[model samples]
Target: MATPKHDLPDDDIEYVSKTEMKREMTALQQLGEKLIPLDKKQLATLKLPERLFDAILAAKKITANGATARQKQFIGKLMRDVDPEPINELLNKLAGLSDRHSAWLHRLERLREGMLADPKIVENFVNEHPSVEIQQLRQLVRNALKERELQKPAKAFRELFKLIKQYIPEPALPGLEASGPEEEDEE
Candidate 1:
């Protein structure tokens, strides 16, 4: 295949090619799809144009596969008119937050598992989190272990996770702590 001729030398031309533009639009549409699954509060944080926001809301309501695909293409077209850099940045931040939240939850799960496997861990946990209710946590752990042994419904096991989440303060994300205390003052 022959290479397409450029009007000027590659270095002289500053504009993106048609193919590159199409790829960018496609990427933005995929970003829009990701945003669709987010709740209203999360979507509000993006600060998208009114028309584009309405389009996303409408696209989300579309259940038919063919129509949804078509709407997504339309959204891509709309995205071409808007600056995608900020949108991409925000999406990356949100994704990072989700990853951090998942890691935090996994850490809690491992702590719970460790406590259950070794009763001694409970003493260590109570010592670390002095505000935690020791008796309540111990009772829950015991019940959770019994539930696991009997292969019954995991009610106590789930409760143990909830209790752990409540008692153990979430590790603050870097850079977020600077603005942390000020947020409470605004409210």
Candidate 2:
């Protein structure tokens, strides 16, 4: 086999092997697949390009296996131009699979348990987060305990966790800008 002639020197020529290119495209396709099931609220949070977002939405509507696979590959081609770090971070967060998010959830679980075990345990949260409503927190703890005793569905139990999550927000993941509900444009 003869090598193709080129003006650039061998060292100046940058070539990506077919194997590596295929690997990258496969990874992008997997990422795009992950985006397909996300609800509108979750998808709106990402800074995805319009074309890629539309492709994801379209992929959601495709029911045939072959068509879905081809659409996913098309999405991979579009992802080549987009940065993926933020998307991965947000997806991890939504899934609650990130280390920091797991720890945050565990902490909230512990807090919920403490509140259920002792109503006075809420003072800990009050001291730590002044925004917590004392009455609401107490009511939820009471309702959760009642649910536990009565062996009913954990409606209030889950609500108790939501309340804690609301008052004590998750810390921002490293390398991502943290935006609070009240964030304003800086001068």
| Each prediction's whole-model lDDT (CA) | 0.73, 0.80
lDDT of 2 by residue, 1-187 (tens): 9988989778987899999999988998888788899876566667678998899999999999999989989999998997788779877876657787778778889988998887567887888888778888889888989999999998889888888877877787655556443221111
Q: Which candidate should be chosen as best, given lDDT against the real structure?
A: 2
For model 2, what is the C-alpha lDDT against the true structure? 0.80
Q: What TM-score fits each model? A: 0.59, 0.70
Candidate 1 clash pair list: none
On residues 56-119, what C-alpha lDDT tens digit does candidate 1 reach at each position?
Answer: 8898899999999998887877777766655655555456544554576678889989999998
Question: What is the alpha-carbon lDDT of model 1 when measured against the actual structure?
Answer: 0.73
Worst 10 residues of 1 by lDDT: 178-187
lDDT of 2 at 111: 86
What are the candidates' C-alpha RMSDs? 8.5, 7.1
List candidate 2 segments past 4 Å from native: 1-15, 64-66, 116-121, 128-131, 142-156, 173-187
